[model samples]
Target: MRPHTLALLLLLLATPAATRLASAACAGEKFPAGRAYAACEDLPKLGASLHWTYDAAKSSLSVAFVAAPAAAGGWVAWGLNPTGEGMAGAQALVALAGSGSGSAAPTVRTYNITGYVPLGNVSTPLDFPATDLAADAAAGGRIRVYGTLQLREGMRAVNQVWQVGASSTAGAPDKHAFQPDNLGAKSKLVLAGKSPAAASPSPAPAPHASGGGAASSKSPNAAAAAAGVAAPVALVLALVGFLATV
Candidate 1:
């Protein structure tokens, strides 16, 4: 066999058996995005994250890339702002990497994210300079993502977060949508999937009370913990193919 062909064969067989095992663990599990989380092989390298909801403004979606970081990290979101084009969606390409510190920007074979399954038709394979993307609320919701890397062995994987919405149309997929930069902050992003449980006017802060004051019943530590889950996964992507550390 030729040199490149031989290398490819080794890569397929040499992948840590854990990868397949992890894929199996994720199989049929509901992604934070709502749909059945795909198998590990089918999942994005960043793990089964993609928890999303509309922003505090209710006009935009807020997507957190991961649930918690391996240690300390933040999430990203993609949302739409241009009310134009009837085109109201955006993309957030996050760099996931490492353990502990949990983030990195690599110089790997960069490819565009093609989101989830059926939507693959709409997803386009792309390349970039290790930057993240953010569209509108709807844009961040349900979608397919994948990338191709031109490394010594070449690489490809799909990372998806399915959309969630309140559409009653039969057989209609509830899409995750966002209005646009209605609001945002550093170390965070926005995109809301279909979450009926999600509060309108914005998801109520976890510590909030129905009457209008911080509730002693709710634990602030718990909310902070949930927030951290997002950080690790955000950083995971930076590990796999990042060319450099962030």
Candidate 2:
């Protein structure tokens, strides 16, 4: 390859690595802009963690729960109780292990937790966009389950709980695994960002006529912005690398 061509190829190769580094840094901390959670709390007892982002502007709530790996393939369930205490009368999202060919994506079911015994029956799924759910292998022969829930509601908070099982027939017996037990500490849905009503309108700044040019690149905020701009390019390079390896 020509010297300049080789240099260009090397630059291209570095692009993906740079992008991955940036993404990894943001991993659990960031979600899709409007979809990201303001907090991620660990459920140590259940070997799981929860992340949530609330958009007060749109009255939307995005939730993601990751459970510890279950080698035999199991299930993870998250419940939201509008009334408070235990799992009774809570809306639940249960993710079960995929079967056979379609196993890459775990099947998700919505339920209404009724009765003191926590008998959850199939209920209406949320009207919001369908969530992305999957199970993947983790270190030490464990399987990790990841899922997201998007909800549109007026409530500011709700009591939450999570459960996991050793088999796919977990949660309700009609579903899979055995009965799922609560995993971690007390959980709830709390809004993070500013509410629409709390935000005050600010007048737009007048444009400067003098050609002072753009702000200094060395400025801390400017550097951060530049890094954000480069993120997309890095992601593209990472994709190219994966395709090349394939």
Candidate 3:
């Protein structure tokens, strides 16, 4: 076998493993009613994901946050913390599932996390302004919360917090679990319109919720995206093997 041919065959065999490792959680995620974003990340914790677009000139950010509740009839949430890296100062958007009949759409609300207690259905205005707050249920019992936020001029990054609760009381989010995954849910979010590589393993301060013990823990969308990658990889390997023999 020619050296060049062997190299080609090796490359082909290596392709699928490379593709799968590079696959991100949101690579093929679908939004309700065909919503889209320029960038996204499979957040490292809480089985949550974030899709977003940032307009630097206008200092505006639009985001779609996806996650499932801890149980049926539960709630999920996402928020940005301007003042610190934890939940105390976070400007949050919480989503509640619809009525048992499934007639109502999931509801989205904003909460100003002043401390570590249950919000009790209070819809507090965000410290930093947000608009178009909304939520909808998705396949696999996940819920998505969408919103646009106005940020200070030239802001480049901020702390982010997300959570899931087993239930809600009177439309407010109950406390999330205290497991390691839950506690690890908060991280620094780079406000860039780029790939997921820039978002993971946050370089900012280690996350710690000030008001309550904040933490959270993954998404199912990655499997769908990875499946799409397999077809092309198989074709490449087959073609390479045929060429090597010839």
- Against the true structure, what is each candidate's TM-score? 0.21, 0.50, 0.75
Give the Å error, residue 231, model 1. Answer: 33
Q: Per-residue alpha-carbon lDDT of model 3 for 34-96, expressed as tens digits? A: 345655778888788887766666777777899989998889999999888878889999899
* 82-169: candidate 1 lDDT, tens digit per residue: 2121212223243222224322231111223333322221224333222223222112222232221111121121123322223212
lDDT of each: 0.27, 0.48, 0.72
Error of 3 at 231 (Å): 17
The positional error of residue 220 in candidate 3, measured at the CA in angstroms, is 29
Identify the leading candidate in terms of TM-score. Answer: 3
Residue-wise lDDT of candidate 2 within 119-169, one digit each (tens)?
A: 343435643433444444434333343334455566666677767655543
Best by lDDT: 3
Q: Which of 1 and 2 is ahead in TM-score?
A: 2
- TM-score, model 1 to reference: 0.21
